[model samples]
Target: MWNLPYVFPMKRVMLMDIKVLIVEDDPMVAEINKKFTEAVKGFLVVGQARNGMEAMAQIPVKQPDLVILDIYMPQCDGMEVLQEIRKQDRPVDIIMITAADDTVTVSKALRQGVVAYITKPFKFERYKAVLEGYRHFKQTIMQKENLGQEEIDGLLPVRMTREERDMPKNIQAQTLQRISQYLLEQAQSFSAEEVAAGVGMSRVTSRRYLEYMAEQGLAERELYYIAVGRPIHRFRLVRQPEK
Candidate 1:
């Protein structure tokens, strides 16, 4: 008996890198973002812009799949850039990367249509998660020409009100994400002060995020003491049960 070789038609994968634009007023920050984007697997940093005016000009020339935008800048700000892009009917996705967390600004950005908003002083893991999520989203968008309700929901999740997303006031979602990233990398328990130093934020800010995670069961919190009158609080990531 002779066996014939069967070569099934493989599912084609588009290997082309997703082009991206870095739009931040800070030169050093832009450089860091460039390096970070380059380090990611399927992304290519196509161009960099230092100001909103520059970003406006480069958006056309670069024609990026995505733009990482900073909210504050000279000449024009990120919000302005986003407005201009919409005004011109550009189809590029945007992720707001800024230091501003005021509700007014955040609400404005959400209304104006940002794929995501990340605060400054975020971890590499957080950045990586954003890009990876976008990668999944892009693939879904490409593969599905017409999406059903479930598919649409999977691609662009149903929008929850700001209250739902921000359950506990005084806690920034971005900061919580940074803390989650820290937990992912650390096996040893840590203090809020240590998280503050590690993530370049204040102890109070770090504790807020840590405590919030504890409330959500994303992290475990315990009290410990070392030659002190008062007990110290420590935290570690919680292990989730397998499906």
Candidate 2:
């Protein structure tokens, strides 16, 4: 016990802290998101923007590794900010945290290459999960010189299989693709009535296809409320037809 060596072994550790920017208009929601971000390991909130304009301004200055963006802000919308970021060819990754559950918004965000899309009224666990998953994904890419097929598969979403791709009875693949293309081209969500008119189908037929698509995970159905009368049922395509 008395004859111990003076030298001691040491191990070196490296950490990569991710810089994050929160672009949300609501103060309360922004604060909550900030707390959630902090709760996750290896993530830091570099800045906060109340609207799209502020987001655009701070993005270049802060140069955050990631952005948690929200839709429906004054001066400009989140989609506009996303487009601007893409136009500038920024390296920043984005995760949408907003109430914009409409298919159009989600589809646009996906097309813009957002890393994650989280709807409003989400729990802490859900928030934590995405941040943690993003962290793992970022680190895996940064640390690896090359990834194997299995590793690459882990990073991407599971593709639909041929057996699982079959359409429901009375739902035709050609018609569904046409409807999906129409939804993709529109700037906003539409009702079944509008979809029928645009796609040359009856309202009942369009509604049936829309609902079927929604059930198959290719489309989203949302209820839009007006001041007068009952809620309007709207549909939007969430993803392109799987090949």
Candidate 3:
């Protein structure tokens, strides 16, 4: 059976740990951020700092690959720490997690090169998404010494079209695209079970997507019965008429 990596050619590369440091003025917030960072795979919480002063003092010692920072703090603000890090040419990525939602602060952070900015009172799911995104971003860049255009595109964020964004919540664009590509390669109609096997997804999921595609006029659905058992539903890519 062909797996996802096999279907789309990919190189095997060893993944290194993404060391992280949590820098928040509030002790409780810092701890929570630390826990969230550790929840994601391939990330290690190297240290935690309660304020910007302590953060700067420990940054060189910890040498973390990333920092989860807060904007408001005593001693020096997060912005100052960020600027100082950049001024010193420290090789570390920052993700801002704070209540400062003003345009100037946000613009400054972007200028300082923060990979992600999440405002306060954000949901845990959003927090996880940001962390996962950063993980993928780091993994993709580090895997290759030199990246091709495709590799570069993979690193950048994809802007989903209106139709794609409106797709059912359960259906992901990437998976749909994969199934569509696979179906286009087939010469005849195939059952959901066959598609499931080909795409490395559950039969139920494959069936759902196939049904959706059929409804969207992307595929043609048909029913066929063998000698005596129950009839089975099969699907194939919709034939496009020649011009």
lDDT top scorer: 2
Model 2, 162: alpha-carbon shift in Å?
13
lDDT of 1: 0.78
- Candidate 2 — which pairs collide? none
Candidate ranking under lDDT, highest first, comes to 2, 3, 1
Candidate number that wins on lDDT, 1 or 3: 3
Residues 104-203, candidate 1: write the lDDT tens digits: 9988998888988899899988998888778766865785577654335434546444354445778666777777787778867788988898889999
Candidate 3 per-residue C-alpha lDDT over 1-243 given as tens digits, one digit per residue, 9 for 90 to 100: 332111211234657889998998888888888887888878999999988999999999999999999989999989999999999999999999999999999999989999899999988789988887787677556755877543454344453343633568887667878888888788777789889998899999999999877654457677766555666777877522111
How much lDDT does each candidate structure score?
0.78, 0.82, 0.79
Candidate 2 worst ten-residue window by lDDT = 1-10
Off by over 4 Å in 1: 1-9, 157-243
Report the error of model 3 at residue 242, Å. Answer: 29
TM-score of candidate 1 on Cα atoms, chains taken together:
0.62
Which pairs clash inside model 3?
none
lDDT of 3 at 185: 88
